[model samples]
Target: MTLALKYAARSDRGLHRSNNEDSVYAGPHLLAIADGMGGHAAGEVASKVVIAALAPLDEDVPGDDLLGKLHEAVVSGNDTIAELVDQDPDLEGMGTTLTAILFGGGRLGLVNIGDSRTYLLRDGQFNQITRDDSFVQSLLDEGRITPEEALTHPQRSLVLRALVGHEVIEPTLQVRETRAGDRYLLCSDGLSDVVGFEKLAETMQIADRQACADKMIELALQGGGPDNVTVIVADVVEEEPQPQATQAFESSNNHMHPVGPTTSPPRPPVQMPPQQPPPHQATMQQPPQQPQKKKKRGRKIAIIVAVSVIFLALIGAGIRYLAYTNYYVGVSDGGEIAIFQGVRGTVLGVGLHRKVEGSCAPAAGPDCRPLRIEDLGATNTTRANEGFPVNDLEAARRTINTWRSEDQQPEPQQPVNCPTPLPGSSATSTPTDVPSLPGETPPGSSTQPSC
Candidate 1:
């Protein structure tokens, strides 16, 4: 019961865009699509970085470790994107949607994040295999919007989760059994956004895999391919007698490796040659060098080390002084309310951090505006960053509450009681205005407090 994957992939820049921002990788066992998102071509860079991360996993892998390897690759991709953003100050806010599938024997492993999609057509039934992490999807799940409404929703493409160079990558991972007739498709919003599910099913029903992909891109263009389109169409087929097989796809700009008909053979991993250490390790491992040279080198090293240590110490002390004296609250690179040693956002691509223990959310009030007007579950990170720095969650809450309270106008206060006279009798009283409370002052009262 051996299984092999036959996949065809295609990417197009579409009518509106001059350059194709979408990237696709198709191999014997792995198929992936990444939709870039950002201005100034940063999105293209992000998508290609992700594809490159997944390029090494094209061969068959262990069924048990497939999910783990996929996770590691995607995590590495996110970290690489973070490092890229760190290197380039202008590439901030770049992100990409990744949807990938790993075929390990008869089981299909899917790792997805953001709004790209993976779909399955089996036994004449059609199903969307991956859930889109989008604002409108949340609305649809809450029964707030209908399927038709989701298509035209203003914020439909506003992805809720994505690999945006964050410290964490939360792609959904799943393993599912496959049958001979099962057909799978991985695509970006460029195709799924335009072609309806029924249209997709009808297009997939086409006999030729390349034609299926080409038709999908065609329909997407007909529906106004406002974004870059990328598609991967793969089918599960029974093992044949042919020991090796390779196919070229006319619709694909990328070439997929020859998926063979023979059972996957276990290949030994490439090993590096054993070698002696170059400098530091060799010095530490070897016994004391010649005593005379050692003493002379050690003395020179000691002086140099001492001077370097002194300089570093002075710089560290200055940094500590500034940290404690001029600390403030701001959102970290990971979008958490954090205390920083310097300014809120990074300056010149260099970041500052002092771990704070809390997450801030919008204060639910009748008068409070919704943080994400179109995105239902999105928290107002800006409002969260407005809070002052505090030690714990409780204090963070208090700080944010205090900030909000200060923002509101003070309520009118009641008039203070003086020694007033009754109907028939008069009581003596000081002819001066009185204060009610620290934060309160009565209307029409002229009371000025010490500055």
Candidate 2:
């Protein structure tokens, strides 16, 4: 079955901004939102250019060809904006973030750049489909921070990649299967930054699309929309026969299907026939369209599987970091006490840690100790402080020495065991020395597990 959308979209200047720097387009199969950046009227121009560039993909595109077509549209937008910036020095920094979706042949073509977002609401679970190309997002990916931390990060607004007049724009693209009851949302950061995802999921459950879009806008306003806000709320419904004229109609306007690449503005609407032809007559001129289901499977199940794999990968990484980076004073193969950087034994077929430079000299080998624990692979700054386990390597040597000194002390003064001197000759046998720890030397022996 062919996939399509029933969507509503709106753009607001917002409470703080004097003018709306956001541009939006919503249609049966094409939905997009752009948030422009820069001062002066450049923001508006950039956003408008982005929407103009992407407006053509609304027409029906086959699943196999959809990805290429989407790329062409985005490249056109990037080039147009870059050319404008080059032509005018004042608009040099002006650029816009574009997030759009093309739905056809039961799959969605996703194109994203900058911080604008795309989200999917399936099976009562809301999942963000696109990742942001921002600085804080990199931190999150590196495991330095959690998703909750990224939201309120002071530098969250600092985007690393955007459509700004770059010679080359690296836009993110993906294709996913679309379902009959699925709902998709595209919005500018003005709405997303202020509105929490929980609230969005709750409000999106409203039956009416317009009502849902309005509620989202209202929530952004209540949160003091600091920038221009744009929203598109679209729900996928069962495909049905659409009248020929209605195919050209959009939620915002009766925009015609853009034919070819041109710098010109939106084309004038085509005049319709006075008498509408029967639905049967329309089919004769055009072949029936078929939806191409590429890898159409259980979407939520796929999500769960992907999430499980990612979670396991993260846990495995954390465990390895903890095990491999451990450093402490321990016994070496030569029976000499020394500081060890890695874990004592092999785990998962890898050493716990390696020897690093430090104050304690390596007696077994001629190598030196690491200057700090960080030299051993604990790059995260949070764990470098005094709270670190065995952080004081020099002090650790002192503790190990105390243990050795106690072991060397003479046994407590107590009553001696009197043995019966039988007539046999076994009274002269000496007592054997007792060992203290695993791999430890005899009590009188010098070397042991120590730093």
Candidate 3:
């Protein structure tokens, strides 16, 4: 069944704001809102210009393609703003907060920058769809301020990124599926500042699209809308009901023992760690050694060798687990970024199963060792990329091949082992102090020759 959208949009010049620096576009399947930002009148001009520039995109396209088009539109709008500012010095620093939604093909494409926001309401729940790019938002993300404090922050309107003073501006884009009975709201900070989520949800639940937009703007005015206000409402309509499992939400599937009907309890929710670890003391005492020092030396060496082999084997197993789980490299314009274990933007990409083993075996060279594979049960795993589903081993292999096609750098057929440092040299097994990703630590591996 085809999914459709019913939407309405409105904008207002708030009580304190002299002019309407906000704009809205509402089509059958397209909805957009922009809140202009500049001390002078140029802000209104910049936002209107962007709205005009993006007025032509088709809303029925795939989410990724819609995102690409929105990105291009933002770039073009940035160029337009830069040219205008160059021509008129008074227009310098003019920018805008943009939040847009294109709903069609049973999906919704979301784009935003600055402080404008998008939200989704479904199943008696509401979720924010856009992350604000503002000083207060960043502070909230870092736990430096509470949500209440952010509402009255001295520099709450200050934006970290916007479409201004440049030839190109990249927007954050997301692709999400939409279903019947789902609702979306797009609004400027002016509305969000005055009308909280609970109130917004209540308004949406009780009113039609036009009434919802009007009521939100009215509430913002009551709270002394110091800035321009804009709001949009979109309702998803599908002819046939679809299963909820295929939506973008994280899965909460319970695990059952392979042999038993259900032996394990449901997994607990993921929780962030505390700031520090609790202290504990060991109670067991070691037995006293009684022997000639020479007699124990050989036994110690044998045990050390066995432990070393076991550690290497564990590392290999971990790598194999990542490989079969559809791990892939996500290359942003910033540089080559890796997405591993469902976390995005790791700096160094680890090739767990490179084909170096096929052409250059370990006998030919140490670097040619075959990649390892491991299968951890489904309960403890997630896909490799941000918003990506986990794939099988065959899919991961194909993805690796695709990455290798663009990576033309020559590889040493044999692994080049780093030589052991001579006596008196500062030596350590850990790699250099490298920075970690959004939610990861630098991998702990030996700098010593693995070959």
Candidate 4:
């Protein structure tokens, strides 16, 4: 399908400006807005040059080809403006903000610089497409001011970047898919800085392209219109068939610009002819048909299979976790007391108060201690009132020490039944003496027990 647009554009001097320095050109596939700056009519000349440079690319540009050609147009406009200023010193430092859009191939390619803006209205919502290259925006970026503060900043009109003099002006370009019923508005700062997005959206919602363009200009004029105001509104529409060659018909004189009442600036209009009689007309009719069943069914099955695989993987993971944490308790012997086999920890709140007995330290090695009581492998205790069972053995020891310090308690006076070689503990022991053959003195010891 060949995509097209119905567009209307206008530029007004406004109440405050001396002569209109803003210029706009828009068509089904071509839309450009430029706001000029400088003294003595130099701004006017620079803007006109930009509009002239971009008017030709509107004919037919593929989506891929749009960015490069649009960039070239900006540079070309800059160079032309620079040459004009060189011929006359009065045109020095003359510059303008240029924003243009080409809509075709079911996409919109945008190129812009300075403070002018382009907005996309889609599904009853409008969004700004370009950022302003101005001092106020710079202040906002630096975090020195809020967006509301910057909006009313006195230096808001001072542009930081623009197409000026002999400098090369390559604009930033953005491309996005265009949809049916989409509407676009391109305008100078005169309209944007004064009129908020909500008000613009309201006007766009109720007005057609021509009415929307006029209303934007009207609002700016009402708001003191401190600068030249310009607006171009374009709406995505289906292209209609063009009729055979016919004579041009002009609109009424009252509708024409006062300066060129007879000259008649061209109207970009497309005329459609009656349904044709040709052998290839069926090919052009766009075949009507019933929907394909196979494609829709295939899509549905793919979604179901993907969802099922994810569900099964989650179920398998849960089963593996339950088998690992359930095992044995404690046991006993003569002098030595063994605790439960495997990692264990004392649960608080056992005796008079709910406080576990034991200080904890992070475990270091086989002899040092394990990080967790579980790392102890297994434990058994001969006496029930021994030290606490801690899943983190070292942590348990530290905790015991902390409690002892806080309570200022002395070591136990009674001989507690601790293991000769403590369970799950590694401590070096002294060598014991043995009698040699009933009569000889021990090899390393001189003293003997009195008879």
Candidate 5:
């Protein structure tokens, strides 16, 4: 089956920011988010330039060439930034984080730099698929801090790498197979930094992509929106075949515009016939002719009514097909996890889906657990209320199994003390020499806790 993306994109200046410094694009073949950094409005310029440079790559590319095209485009963007800096000394420090995905040959080619992120929701699992190129990420990788401590860490925004105009930056790139029901999210650190992963996962579970995007922005704003936020949500789905006639019409008329008075040539004045004397009422009546006219009018009305009915029927059938082909995992009326068929919510107050069966089947596997809403915790319970949409019944089952496995895992340990710095390491240097971690006093300062 042919695969295509159904996607939505959004950006917000945010409650606290004076100006938006983020750029985003979502198209049939590409999705990208860029978060800019600098001063004097240079950040905005950096992001816009990079986005414009990459926008042309939204067209179809051969699957094998996807990564090559993405890499070339990114390097070109970086070069453009360097040129701009040369033209204007004031823009010297401008740069931006880029996270983008190109779709081709039923696969995804992803490119990332800086702290912007890409997350995936496939089958019944959700997780971040890109590692951040930032100092905080480095700290986490080295086991010097826990995920929780990293959030409030003062240098959380200290990016170790990005598309600065000074040099040709190498970005992380990879390709992965795509599935029809997978959902992907690309966003700036503005959203990822403020919104917890649990909230993000729950919001991504929304079946309506547009709604999911909207909720993500709202969550960022609620969390004090310290930076400009941009989000792109895309879903992979089987492409529906279009009638050849419709396709032809669309191709021909897509750019056509209606004639307006300003552009149209002056109409020739209508020639009028000389005024005629009124005919007698009897002659004007034309009784036999009137019957023929009425018959023709009746036939036209009947034809229009028949066509209208047929068109409506076809539309209803298409909607029903879309509603039934998907499935979701949600809490049932009895509060137990259950598998459902069809889309969530309703049309004209009629439910669009029904419970197919309880998610937990004792005989299915040892991992199967009868989970209820009360047991799911706040974030997961919220997800259940919204429903975790999946491609099919099997996907729904996998999601349930994933939840069961997570439930069986142990609790996380508390944050530990920061490790001692190695000789000549940056960690022991003064702030001027190198950035210092949280809870670590710079040289000449009073002693403090090491965590």
Candidate 6:
């Protein structure tokens, strides 16, 4: 089946921002969002430049070339930033996060840099497709912090990577197969940071694309919009959307900076003439139908209840899969090296992970070493405390083995000098006691001296 996108785009300056630094674009074949960072109007310029660089890809592209095109466009945008910075040194520190998707040959080419996000909703399931390039995200991956802690982290807004007028940085790129009913949402951190994931999923379920985008913007503003918010909501459909009135609806009274072709405003309700009863029924009185109506209502309630239960079950299963499939190396309660299955954090006070192997445990095999956390040295000890995430049990074992090899190596000894005896002095004369080198202990002391 031929697939096409029906999309809406919206942006607001938000309550706290003096000017909007976010830019967005939505078209039949592409959707993109950029969140700029810098003081003054430089942020606005950064976002606009990046968005403009990507706007050209909103046309037909071959499936195989989608990723290449996206990468080239992102590099071009980075180059433009460099040129701008050269022209005006004040814009040197300015940069922007980019999250975009290009549709071609019934597939999607996705690229992301910094913290902006892209989410996909299909078959009643919602998931984030792009991982954030941010400090908090790395902490979460290493199990040093939980998702909740990341939200309020002092450096929550610190983006680790972006297109900042310097050397070209590679962006996260992927190609995804699309389905007719799939829906995608691309937005900056302003909306994502404020609105929780559950609320976003609920709003995205709205059938009308425009309505969904509008509700998302409203939710961000309601949540005390601390940054500029931008949103683009698009749905994949088998049939191409027909052209409609070109009127644009403002996202907010404060400011309306929508990019690309905005979806038409909600159409006025059509008035219909009242109809009289049919000729046969006009002469006859209709019987009361409250019982049938009640039966239909009860059936509807039952269906709703069943669907909710199924959805919850699916969500639970997905969570369980995510929790148990991964493994990590960490310090156990006994202060020894250990292997854990599942995530490091807990949910509602229940631990999400379990210690699967302790130092030299029976299941750890003959090569396992009875090593304590302290034996790993200071650097590795810190890593053990944070938990070293691995893809599977084999990888965890490999990590332990590598650490063991490093620990087994002998430390290099420091050289020391001994004074030569005088030619006429007795051969057995005791060496004169001299002050030791700085930071060193004297001879015969518990600590060795540097001569």
Compose the digit string of candidate 1's lDDT tens values, residues 61-144.
446687898899899878877986776555678888899987876787899999999999999998998999999999999999
Give the clashing residue pairs of candidate 6, or none: none
Give the residue spans of candidate 4 off by over 4 A. Answer: 61-63, 241-451
Residues 1-451, candidate 2: write the lDDT tens digits.
4445777776677776655667776655578888888855566667766666665455344457777888897888788778766655556687889899888747888989999999999999998999989899899989999878877889888888888867678689999988989988888888888888888889889988777888888888899877777788888876544422212111111211221111112222232223323311111122223222211211222233324423443454555557655666644444344456645566445455665533344552554322333232233223333223465566655544444443334558666555666797665544358857887655555432221
Lowest summed lDDT window (length 10), candidate 2: 247-256
Stretches of model 5 off by over 4 angstroms after superposition: 241-451
TM-score of candidate 6 to 2 decimals: 0.56
Report the lDDT of model 2 for residue 127: 88
Q: What is the C-alpha local distance difference test score of candidate 1?
A: 0.65
Give the root-mean-square deviation of each candidate in angstroms: 18.2, 21.7, 33.3, 28.0, 30.8, 23.4
lDDT of every predicted structure (CA atoms): 0.65, 0.63, 0.59, 0.58, 0.71, 0.74
Q: Write the per-residue lDDT of candidate 4 for residues 189-259, one digit (tens) a residue.
A: 98888887778888888556776777887888788878777777777765553211211111111221211
- Tens digit of per-residue lDDT, candidate 5, span 134-188: 9999999999999999988999999999999788889999999999899999989
Residue 148, model 2: lDDT of: 82
The collision pairs in model 3 are 320-372, 320-373, 367-415
Number of colliding residue pairs in each model = 0, 13, 3, 39, 0, 0
Which consecutive 10 residues in model 5 have the weakest lDDT in total?
244-253
Better of 1 and 6 by lDDT: 6
lDDT of 6 by residue, 196-307 (tens): 8889999988998877888998999999989888888888888534322111122222565544444433332231112332211111112443224422332343334324
Q: In model 4, state the lDDT of residue 307.
A: 35
